[model samples]
Target: MTGTEPLEGAAPAVGAPLLEATGITKRYGRYTALDAVDLRIEAGRTVSVVGESGSGKSTLARVIIGLERPDSGSVRFRGEPVRGRRARRAFRHSVGMVFQDPYESIDPRLTIGEVVAEPLRAHGLYRRDGAARVRELLDSVGMEGVDPDAYPHRFSGGQRQRVCIARAVATDPELVICDEPTSALDVSVQAQILNLLLDLQRRRGLSYLFITHDLEVVRRISDEVDVLLRGTVVERGTAEQVTSRPQHEYTRRLLGAVPAISPRQRRIGAPLISDAPAVPDSKESTESKESKESNSA
Candidate 1:
């Protein structure tokens, strides 16, 4: 790949794909994590990658963010090759990441302000009056007036996630990679976080590379969906189209597994009663009803 300079500005030209990866491949010893994966993200749009565990979703994210170099193929940002120090620095400035686990992604020792300001410090973008910027960032994510001296452990799971998001956007990056960002939170808190992301995108015109396993979450947030299986993209299309009318067998099976509500069930607000036989309940039994229910979803 040729070394080329990225655009100085964070935003891409209107209607252009901000990031593109073509024929990307990666392998670990005998196992391939990705196989000739091609993906694109348009400016100011959300493109989601969905797959089961070990399906190479995380590998793709790592490659895009420059954490892992692909064994083959190329990555481009704003129509330029992401090669050499300057180009990579430009890429880092243009892209931000919100990792899967808020608890582990952040350092417990650092105060909230220091954690959020780390990106600015790395890029030499920190200002002498940077405390104002920190406050503004926190307010943007709905955490106004939070004490800058407070450590991460003082915050709840959802609050820690908010701080993480605050840090990711500190540089006002054009693209954000969200890797299963809400998977660790409770269902109610997940909704709030999703809405916060949506608001941020709307206000900043940010493009998102959202990686998750939940199709329902994909349906809610993505403009397009790419379904990966065994390190290859099995199917891709508009979110509604892919989820509603999958063409590949793998895609079909994945969609089929989603718990759906039938028309009758919707009308009754519950599933139809079945006459199936119940399992014999005993304290000494190996199987428990709670265990079965826990594994249902």
Candidate 2:
């Protein structure tokens, strides 16, 4: 089968979600990392989960990817339970992950070619033309003409992230879970990586479970958004709805925190600093102090 086609028996049934989690809960000792969260992704679209740090965004990604099994609830891929060894192995082949830190995600010991080919080799997809396939994947992510034999450390942060993205799509998976994929890059580089993701999604017909703390990113990449706060989803709606007219207090706070490109571009009624006090002038302070003293007299 070609890269564009879904894997055999991996396609979802009609009207079924590509991936779904219901009432997911995870705990470590007495602390709950995830509290009864429900999320779903549709085919060929992006679903983003947005929250602050420690809000269970990564935990949800882990649970959905089977890195950590939830204490309660279930995850389904293609409308079937992701349980048992065989089922999980199959599920993994159809899902790829781009982790937050590029520096740590790739092995320093391996060459770029080997890093990208690891998934293909693991899934038994690497064959006679595997090297060429690896090169093709690298080029797709704008890494053309670089020697694949070079170690990951030789590349810049943005370059390494491009490599990570190449590896994520090497297997031509149906879904890619991006955990803060561009958070570590510089502002300009972040735009490039996000555009690459959008391009890949269009070309490969891939779905995304995009997890980020940045609401601006949600505006750019997501079709639907789920606002996660302290392990629970406080709001869910279309990307525009959640970002532009957020109803939940937590979601509004998150949007308010995003730095606008210019003061004029900031949302109407959304201040540059939310609930922040203005710097007091020395003259104004003295005048107010004198006024207070005279009033007391």
Best by TM-score, which number?
2
Question: What is the C-alpha lDDT profile of model 1 across 1-297, one tens digit per residue?
Answer: 212122111222246678999999998987888888888899989999988888899999999999999999899999999999899998999899999888899998899999999999999988796888888888788676678889976666667788899999999999999999988765545666787888899999999999998887787788888888878887888788777777777777777676443555457754222211111123223123223322332
Compare the candidates by lDDT and give the number of the best one: 2
Pairs clashing within candidate 1: none
Residue-wise C-alpha lDDT for candidate 2, range 101-208, written one tens digit per residue: 888899999999999999999999999999999999988887777798999766767677888999999989999999999887655456667877888898999999
Models 1 onward score TM values of 0.83, 0.83
lDDT of 2 at 237: 81
Taking all chains together, the TM-score of candidate 2 against the true structure is 0.83
Model 1 bad stretches (over 4 Å) = 1-15, 259-297
lDDT of each: 0.79, 0.81
Tell me the lDDT of candidate 1: 0.79
